[model samples]
Target: MAIVLFALPLAVVVQRLYHDETVTGLERDATRIAAVVPDDLIQRPRPLKRPAGLPSRLTVGVYRVDGRRVTGQGPGRSALAVRGRDGRVHDGAEHGRLAVAAPVPSDEGVAAIVRVSAPYDPTGDRIQRALLAMAGLALAAVACASLLARYLARRLARPLERLTAAAQRLGAGNFSVRAPRSGVREADEAGIALEATARRLGTILERERAFSADVSHQLRTPLTGLLLGLESALERPGADLSAAIGTALDRGHRLQVIIDELLDLARDTEPARRHLDVPAELEEITLRWHGPLAAQGRRLVLDIQHPLPAVSTSPAALSQIMDVLLGNALQHGRGEVTVQAADVGGGIAIDVGDQGPGIAEDAPDIFARRSAHPSAPRGTGRDAGQAGTRTAAAAGHGIGLALARSLAEAEGGRLILRSSGPTVFTLFLPDTSMAS
Candidate 1:
């Protein structure tokens, strides 16, 4: 478009220059001829006439000084110039004729002015041809531009169209829908961004679904137990009634704990940050559980390296994690349960090691909702077998290890089983620096 805008006027000006040059050359020729012609010729009985056998398209004429027509041939049109000097001039009416005049030099004085005119029809014909060629070229240019514009628009639109369709599919619950990659850098980048968003959304939905399912399964056992115990106590009357009521109360408490844990899980899934003192938090939880450890006749060892660094974490989450670990140790550990924290190269490292029968080789697989270990003793709860424990020697419900792992993850740390021996189970928690 820019090229056409600038080139059109330039082409017109060039054509006009070419036509003017042709007219000027013809006028110069006529002037020269008049200058060299004999002065007697002008005073003769008849004025000098145009040459014979001239092309019919060529019109010639002569005019007196006062604009009177003189003798000539070929249409004998009125002169284009009156008393003008020997120079090139254009006819206003004819447009294609060049007019010239020269003084007839004589010994006595200046005789009549010799004016001549010649047709400039060739200039018009050349301009017409040029205009026709220009029109043809312009048509070709328009055709090519249309084809190119359509091709480019289609090429650009195809990928975006696919992306729009994929987005619609995703909106309709097809989480797997993704855009096709094509086009230039910007288009490709947009496609990649859409793909990444889809993947993240799919992952989030899947995790939520799994968490909902796990929570439902975990709650069902306690709920069933509570219902049965309450029914039994209501139907019977004796010392057994009190025991049944107590059991019902215990089941209700366990149900409450499970609900709280689920709530914690949901909250931890959201993005947040907090600052904490690792040693102080650990000391507080351990002190809370010290009585339980003493009653179990197990020694509690806090081999914390001094000047432990402050960490960023959720205080409630960190406390819950430590409680779960200490509870597991006190319930199962036969001798000593050691809690240790120290500065590792990248971050702080905390370990909870228990002198209990170590975890089985299939511990990881067993630590899922609804999974059970038939060889190990079952707790009163239905899904207790699947809880993360070295063995089924715990004194209470079997959710300590699962809760510990959840709480650790909530605080931007992980509870990993470092090693399992015949009488030892060790868990390592990396500090918040490793969260991201």
Candidate 2:
């Protein structure tokens, strides 16, 4: 296809140039022979010798005005000669063969005419051979070009095929799949972008899965406690109706609190600018988890460096973040968990530290959604959904921490892993309450 597009025009141009050169040489030879005639030929007729460099097939004829071949064998016609005119070569025919003619000048005015002729058979055979050779060369060039085009087309097509497959998988909910980069520049660029989109989609999906699973993590503990309380009440002989109802109501209230916090986490709305009492929020959150920590034989300590001032942050967001931190401490930490507060900038810094064998140094990407504890089993909350151990073991830190940090930053705050020796994570919220 490429050969047809480019080679045909090239062949035409080459042939035209060659044909023009051949004709120009022929006309020039005729004029040269006419100019070199000796003066003695006018008085007495003599056969002209073939001019040097003239084709052997070309025959010359000298004629009087009336049209007669004086020496060579050719058609004798008066119109074949361009007499007493400028050096413009005109077409002359000699017995059905192509030729060129020019007038022979002398001391006498318009003395004689000389016509040069070449046999049509030989001239045409030479031209046909040249055309055949040119055609063959053109075909070879076209074949080579076709091969090159096919190679380039295949090179480009394979990457696009991979990209198409990747797109199909993406549409099929396989966001983890990626396309490999082909060496072709444009295809490589597209492949890079395709893989990039795949990574983004995979992140979004993993977060969604974690979000749904998070409900199980946060609510399962309270739900389990509520169930156990009802089960205990049922087991009692002649249980007091008012007492059971009160116990159930209390457990239900705790579950509602968990649900409301989870709902706030899922809202995806911007935080309202307001002053938050960090110490008060810290004390309340610690109190909520006090029972769970005491059950696990671990100590929960609060270290206040100063009279912590109020900062600009949402209480609901802070509560949810504390849940993740304290819940992690309860489930995974050893010894004691200390939550410290301090004054920093226009806000306060709250550090949640767990005295456990902190995260391993080689544990990859701290924020990417992946397993935190490789040995710990993963489940969908079928077993171990009790109040003491929620879904914390199954819900990895990657999902929890990533969400916590994103939420913190979205509300114009910062979350950082201060130290891994004790696995300390610090939270800082700026004072946005004064902003317009």
lDDT of each: 0.58, 0.69
Candidate 2: list runs displaced more than 4 Å.
1-29, 32-55, 82-89, 92-94, 164-178, 185-203, 216-315, 322-340, 344-347, 351-436
Candidate 1 per-residue C-alpha lDDT over 372-391 given as tens digits, one digit per residue, 9 for 90 to 100: 23333333331231122112
Query: Per-residue lDDT of 307-359 in model 2, one digit per residue for the tens?
Result: 76667777878887877777777776787889998877677788998889988
Q: What is the overall TM-score of model 1 with all chains considered together?
A: 0.69
Q: Measured by C-alpha RMSD in angstroms, how accurate is candidate 1?
A: 6.5
TM-score of candidate 2 to 2 decimals: 0.56
Given candidate 1, what's the lDDT at residue 11?
73
What does the lDDT come to for candidate 2? Answer: 0.69
Model 1 ranges with Cα > 4 A deviation = 45-57, 74-79, 83-91, 95-122, 172-180, 213-275, 287-303, 323-338, 361-364, 368-414, 419-436
Q: List the residue pairs that clash in candidate 1.
A: none
